[model samples]
Target: MYSALKAGFLALPYLSLGALAALDGHCPPLGPVLPAPTQPSKHEAVPAAAAALRGIIDQVTATYNGSAVAIGVKSIHESKLLFEYAHTPANKEKRGAQKVDSDTVFRLGSLTKVFPVLALLKLKDRGVRLDDPITKYVPELRGLKKQAREDSPVWVVDWDEVTLGALASHMAGIPSDLITDIAPFGNLSAYGYPPANTSRMLGCSGFFGTAPCNKTAVAFFEHYGQRPPAQVPFSSQTVYSNIAFPILSFAVEAITKRPFAEFVTNEIWKPSKMTRSFTTKPDDALGFIPPKDIWWDANLGFEGPEGGYFSTINDLHRFFDAILLNKLLPPAQTRKWLKPVTATSSTGLLIGQPWEIFRAENVTSDGRMIEIYTKTGDLIAYHSILVLIPDYDLVATMLLAGPEVSGSAMTLMLSRIIQTLLPAVEQAGKAEARAAYGGTYVDKATNSSITLSLSDDGPGFSISRYVIRGVDVPSTDPGSTLPPATPPRLDPPMRYRLYPATANSGRQTSWRAVGTRGTAAQVDKADAQIVWPMASCLTWAMMDRVTYNMGARDHFVFDVERGKVKGVEAVGYGVFMKKEC
Candidate 1:
């Protein structure tokens, strides 16, 4: 998901901050009931942690050819700012040395959408239904009859099923960019003339050129307001839309009457004391998400609610903390804001309001899995991510100022940083009873999913099974929009013997690839057909090589389902696999 090949998941440094993570919470929580982020221990390892973290940033900048980066990591469980690093190249082509800090402002890219979604959720809390037709608020979207043409450029939205919830959750069938509606992988390169993803419609130099643009993002909205819908009905796929949020802004404005920025400022920012946060004007912060690595002069009249704000780390942190801490929204509203819109998504993770619901694999000492609610924002010049470990009361954020030349360089850096700084959840105490956590829970969301075989060491099942590749990437390029050939045969499953508490001599799980099996890569190489007793040992050899160091460690999440094992989240080589029955 972070643009790294699945194989990249296995290559992180073998450092764990588990013991250090047990340190008492020195930082304060975002709210009263929430736990504070874990503070750095006075255990003398803090210096090493800082050094290693800085070294990683230095290495990443060097390899990735970045201009500057600002990163901050803290435990949301506590209030301490554990680590902060800001670096800019010494000699930057006549652009003097820039040292960013907590006060520095950053262009949040699509992350700006979270603010409108927050406003929407606040309205929802006040009895505004998400299921209401979008036209109810923005009357401009009413009664636009479409006449089919032999060939047309601009497409209209299906005004019928376009609900507030669908638009908010990115299921409204809206195009991703205001310019080009589609930029699917392989169909187009990320950097073509007038690339759809990061085209700046701001100043003269906005659209990868010097001459100022004659139009603004407003034109697209006006045209779409009267355009015809695409051929397909609006359902079944979550298309990330830059235009949808602005349309949402229109809906929000119709409800509030005041300007969107003013409404947010008066309603959310000022109340939370996020004084530095802004949707317009007087932001002199040196940080910039330059479009195409070319800086543009300030022109707020162009870019609108889609992504127009420049914010600080602490301010954005405060914004999220306010939501979590119940300063901005109540617990129920916050939960609704973070809930995924499953009707429009196929992946395990999907959008909640405007945030993404993503969980990685790892267990607490008590064998509980941690769920990380997160959002990653990427502009051409800036890249940022906010990861919330709700269970551990931790929030990790990273913002980089430079071109996202490859992809998600910040994601990889932040991932390593999270792993290095935050300790794995304390392994749960073991039970002498076999199959203590064994149960049959079904996850219809996925097929050929985890099938448990519970046995009794005492009254219950005696042992467990474990599987290789906690996450399975088919070795086929995901960017291709091709149809599947045939479903691969389900191989025999391996059960885990979860680590026990009272037993000092026993280990939780082990692996044995007992039978002949082919990996997705091997099958794809053979035209989606598996050869019995496969002659090639290549795939297995590679898998063994990959897993020798980075293997799956299983965790069972309880709070998710209660009283039952519910499901198993497997982590291998940085890949997280969901195996819930």
Candidate 2:
């Protein structure tokens, strides 16, 4: 939840390239795009490189609880990294520190789903349309619709209607996860994080309890294709699902007439020269789950399509380089690699495919807005996040002990490294941007207030900050713990970073609620409860996706006359906040 930009303007990651130089040029070495326009080599970055590296290590180590945490930040235009920080100490010395470098291999969880998507993109380029149904290719599911008998216990809303596009976008009505109530895991179904592999996974509650062949990926799909789904799939959703990935992979495998692994090795991996990356195999690697005592090797087994690949930072950088360099796929097809599968989420976010598309609010130091075509993955032992930032020509990736890391923590760690490597800007261009929308505004109808100021940090031009109060805050529970004197406030305020939407939106910034503050004189989640009787009956997922307050409109509209600020709408919870400044 922490933004590295908040670490003041100076904190940056130091380049730990001691081991990077050892791994020389790749065969058919990539073109010069990655290393061009390079600044002075990392060593000459003024104020000494030691502080930056040490600052990065200290920041990460402060939160990283496990034995090994490796990170890499490199420019898409340059082969060398701006910074690479790896800390692994066995018994606190962190074992395998040397062995776990840019070249060390580790399981890349759901990221494995990317290759199948890549292959599908290639096929799409070759006349395989995306809108067609999977039945068009497999024929195994040609006649199956949401058919169910009177005695059927589960709703058959998802069968027969799933398309290749749906499968790829996770909109196929497949359950959010791949884990089943039956099999290798006993009671985890009580919670949602399902087992990564479906080999021993069996259906119990939703649809496939008595599914005859519940062992392999092929069998599970066959079982579902022949039957009805447990839940409804008509609505396009960005929910997580390992079920759709393997099915998509099967479709790719069928079309290519080659094993997924073999095809990728020849067409994707070998061409990119990612020699260190592998499938279901370890190359002198160690996965630390609970290094408090020992480690465990998390296996993908039949989840190969979902998460069975092992790769390193070096090969990962090279792989992205290949894509950017137009070695594996052309720029046009590669661009499709990051396109949104569906419109489930807001702009800048696309789910269910290999790379998670998030257009970040914060701009790079060089003033370019960032579109993060990134993916986060985890086995029982290893967790990682890899991203390709096309606009800045940057790629940052990292992997570490999973059990000891939270997804937010991992993201923050990477953000810390990324914040430093990005081109630095001395002062924000907030004054001009703010003149039209800055200062205090009050909503007389609701007795609410909003205070907007030029952000003191980050890229100044495109960012603003606001603290809202009164009706702007969600309603509190009828029976609350606090006294009447205490009221809800926006607390630390939220960052209103400007983003480009339509041509009009391009003139201003489009932002949403993203930051969080600590539990210090703040409105609590439990306190903001809905008092309606039917509110309790709403499903968790339903409430999560449905938007209540869009924080004004999708874009901020400012009313200005001559040089004076007038009013603003479609922001915060205010219907209209007239400028009072």
Candidate 3:
């Protein structure tokens, strides 16, 4: 969610008018609902509440080689400003002095998918069903088939399952390789390459390349349209690829009959009064001139539906405000956007339409459950974080420009800041509960698993499991006594450290697991069978069966029935589960 922070002249020297002006066109004005303070306070004094956060930013900037940073937060409850800050390097670059402020815009990278989601909802509002097939809108997909062989012609394959919903939710089963390219439009041999070599390179370049050049996308579809069906499943990467966005952009354009950027500006940005937001042109007033730096040129341009746009923190806060207020999209649609579409094990975060759903800890004044909606962006040399606390009506966004910023590192930093700052707003009054539920649990009936392990010898979490499938087994001679069972050789466990949730409370959970070592090569030779512990398996079994009590904070209870874990209830946080060896 975006925050609304108007640029105002302050008395402090550090808070100069130039800095304020730098923020003017970048920061959005406070929403109408925000209550004005009876008296304005000094802006220079660092609040004790945000001290830890400031320190964190300083440390991250120093560690990551960042040249500039900007941060903003807003309270969804009252639409009031929670905090905002911008910092720049003491040394300047040659082209122009890099000055960061609330208004300074940065390429949002993959965050562009959120806008397409909004567009999809808008289409839905106009009586378009997500279940409708792509062919329904773009007839080109009709009769489209994959080639059986390299020299074969395309043959039709059923695509009834490739629905609009699947495309938006990333279940459309479209291969990442299907993108078309629209680049190197002039002479083919301009780069001193043979015409044949240039043609060959162009044909295969679709599978590679950093950005989704339009020319490449077209070339890919032309040559591979007759190839075998796409095999990759829906994933976060699918949402970020240039291939996915052009198709989505085409759909939006076809539906609205307007340029994608223009439609977004009128339909979402302007109406929401996100004055600083733009998907097409960079804001010159905020110094977001194109081609000013290599990073900027490489990152920003014709905004794609997947991840091409720029905005200030305040503008993003406004965008979030629109979501919470049910202004841009209906409440039901917004909920759909935030709902978990799939489970992501790699990060242990639930994947929503375009958002990542995190079950946060340390929420309410009295410990209670809270949900976090988050998304991160990584471009050439920039990293950004956007997180929303639904229960607390809080939104936080950070953008850093540098040569070495990474999404993972930025997220780690953001998580730390939120954990430290959340308490000041409203403390989650739950006591430090017992650490009884700290160990791993397993369930044999469901054949599922989980493992909970600590990090830095400190409290943390990770997930470890093997997905079992039915397979043929060799039969042993009846007379042959089973060879003496031998214990399976184990390997050193691999650890996945958990980030504590930023919400008030619900499940303060974490995970860990053992790495694949001797399992693959020794499976056939091993005699003794490996099995997961009951508690861990039970948790996995109950995932879909149990009705989780978002309000319940009781002792860690694992309900097992018929040899499978049917339910789990844990106080403070859930126990970690590990897969059987």
Using lDDT, give the best candidate's number.
2
lDDT scores of the candidates, listed in order? 0.49, 0.52, 0.49
Which has the better TM-score: candidate 1, or candidate 2? 1
Model 1 is weakest, by summed lDDT over 10 consecutive residues, at: 16-25
lDDT of 3 by residue, 1-581 (tens): 01111111111111111111101111111111111121111122214557767776777676433366778866665455667777766543444435778878777867767787677678885677766776676666544453334322223324554666666665555654333333434455766744443442343221233453452253444454554544334433433233445566667777888988888889899878898776653634463322224555453223355666778887888888888789987776776676777665544466666676776535323222356778777665666778887544678898876655567767776777677666554321111111222345554444434344432122223333221111100111011122225422222322222222222122233211111122222322231232421111111111111122452211234443443333343322333233222
Superposed by TM-score, candidate 2 places the C-alpha of residue 272 at a distance from the truth, in angstroms, of: 0.8
- lDDT string for model 1 (1-581, tens) is 33343344234211110011110201111111111223334324544666777787777677444456677766554465667777654433233225567766676666777777777767874567878878888755643334223234345455556887777777777555534333322235545644444332322323333332222243443334443443233456566776667777777788888788888898899877787777763434445433334532333233356666667778777777777778888877776676666543333365677677754533222222245677777556666677776644566777666653323666678667766665421111112121334444333334323333323221112223332333232222111122246433332222122231111212233222111123335334543243432222221222223231355232222222333233444333232234343
Q: Model 1 reaches what TM-score against the true structure?
A: 0.59
In TM-score terms, which candidate is top? 1
